[model samples]
Target: RWRIGYAPESWDACLNWARARKIPEALLETAGLVVRTDDGRVYDRFRDRLMFSICDEQGRVVAFSGRILTADKEQAKYVNSPETPIFQKGKLLFALDKARRAIIEAKFAVVCEGQVDTIACHEAGLEHVVAPQGTALTEHHARILKRYADEVVLMFDADTAGQNAAMRSAEPLLAAGLVIRVATLPGEHDPDSFLKANGVEPLQEIITAAPGFFTFYLERLTKLHDARTDRGKLQIAQQIVEWIAKVPHAVLRASQLQQTAMKLGVPESALQQELRQYRQRDRTVATPAETTAPAEDPGHPAETLLLQLMLTDERVVPLVQQQLAADWLSTGTAAELMRKVLRLHAAAAWNGHTSLLGADASDEAHRLVTRLLEEKRPAPERIPAAAGDCLAALKRAALERQFQAIKLRLAQPGLSGNEVTALQQQILDLRRNLDHIPRLSVWRSAKP
Candidate 1:
């Protein structure tokens, strides 16, 4: 339906571009068919690497995504089309043109990370395959894939970076209402190499064994931190609590929390308490403070002010968002949960009151939400009178929780000087914040 032209004039010129360096002829031909470089710079574009031809629906070349092979550590491994008339990286799906019909027929697509991997999937009889062009999966990519199928089988590399990428990708995909199953190749092998050696049966088995994103994420975390030692177990508990706090689904999150507790050989009630304390500390410190005083709660009045603003005035959401992104909030379970909630809301995934209750929410979370919604608002006339009482209650709760965590940590045999100093500072700050409350006048009078 459209006219296409070439500037190199002949296939030989294209072949020369590939042959000038370590690039292979097939890759160069693929590049030539996609683009014509009159300036003879096509070779420079793919100069010393393995080339991946990005094709359109008809299998016609549209762009070239090449990977660097030589020992030069300075160069990036992935390179792609330079925005010509035929190629727009964002608009194109890596191998969808070849696999679209199959994807539509099969009702699923095996999404990988590279060109060769797509070819390997097809060769293995799993014809519905596609990948991104030298980029991570984006919203646009998810929408395009969702058009053909209800589910996407994500097969990424089995590495730390890949796992992290998959987790991030899940957010956007899940937000878009896509069903995603995450799969990883064994060891360091990618789909292409893995399929070539182990045969299709082995690759299929790996796909069958793929775990849900949450399960995989937890497994990855367990592998990263030691859970056998007391300190290790404490750290893991803290980390898992944070993770659970961020999950937007209450039911899903609670289930995950129970499972995580069982795996760590701890009581669910204990884990729930730990997470609750963590969140309370987080919300307490997020409020504006007069000084950086070892991270104590700002008091009930401040917390009420925050909750009131958060629920009643939408404008405060952005302020919370800014503080969270800036990392000014304390690094605790509650802070993590708040950050996740705000992030999901920002991304437009948060729908209603239910969505506000994250994974760590239990009867305690329900109580907090109920209190925020049902608490009697102080009259404008009585605002000053009521503020002190509320602030005092919040401060006490924060101080008690912080002292408990510190006591537990200190009870361990080998407390570092930094840790000891941190605990002392927190206690002092809690006392200081509490002293500012007028209702704590007796305590203030007792102090020097």
Candidate 2:
């Protein structure tokens, strides 16, 4: 158990308590239990607060997170002890010392966004809960979690900041090759309030029903963007492709692409082609190809599609080659890539993309080289029809552009009542006009 205790209203209470026990005042300063002002006065670092000891794996108290009692505007809601010899905030997860056995038994860890939520879960018989104290979930935290469990369930608040934290956390977990699921509380409820409001069973039920990272994020993207139109569909597809491309394994990437394409009602070949283009373009950039929440990318999706088709399909490669004079593409990045792919094929140097640009590509070229070289890829004649679809997507994109414009206006500080209603109605009409993309609710349940 953590060394749960309290500090009184008066700053001197801790100092006096230490003196009565004959604990040296200098030791308190060194331990980060007290702070020395520039004017030479010494006082407790955590006053009028509930103090929870942060412990190491051996259950040694190395730091403290102090929760303030009042809603004081000037002060932070929580205060933590400064870095000391034993504790580095970013390097430790709260309650891990106590949660280790429970985590091992559960075979999965629940990561909460708050220390109080961690305590609340523990009290309600969910003993495997932990929190990232004073920092976001890091690679260090991921490695630590992997020691006890193979998966992490992120029980973050429904608020924007908490949801964003949950999203950011998936990276380190994936990079560490650990399975990640996200569980959310309704409305403005944090885990502590949700537990008290609904009791443990309902809260536990939600966590048990949390979805894997892909299903979780894809559903979120559906809500945030219109899935009814071609533009919206491609936007969502591009975002999913970005994250899928980041997956460290090739076979895994292909499998994810197959599943995503199925869900989007698109050909697996198209998504595979999209990912191939993402890889080629990603290779040339100096910036890290990190995928956060998918935002709008204005890149021409059709041109990239053609380029990818060329890279993988010998049929489509000549289609792009014959029409090199026309410029439907905005950037030469993908065009240059197709040319390289062509030369690679002609020279019989058709190795991986790494051979040309020192970058990794999807497995379609490697896996289906026999199909491609044999001229057996699907629908090479429809390459021109795709141009028609791009033109139609442009027409439909006007609605998407209008929808996004309304969203931008909604973000502005103040608006008149009629303006807000008109905007809301426009969104309602757009929603009705667009085909409703079904959200996935069937998720694998964890142990209750």
Which candidate has the highest TM-score of all?
Answer: 2
Q: Encode model 1's per-residue lDDT on 1-448: one tens digit a residue.
A: 1112223334355556546876775454333333445674333344445666666645577777666666777888666666443454654677676676677676677788777777778867887888877667776676666546667778977777766677766765655456667898878888988887889998888777777666776677788787777777788788777766665567766777788787788899988898899888887777666334566543333443444445544445555543321112333333333444554554455454466576767665566666766665544444433333333444455546656776787788888898787667656655655565444431221111
Please list the residue runs of candidate 2 whose C-alpha ends up more than 4 Å from where it truly belongs after superposition. Answer: 19-26, 287-448
Each model's lDDT = 0.61, 0.71
Model 1: lDDT equals 0.61
Prediction 1 TM-score vs. true: 0.48
lDDT of 2 by residue, 163-208 (tens): 8898888888888678888998899999999989899999989999
Clashes of 1: 7
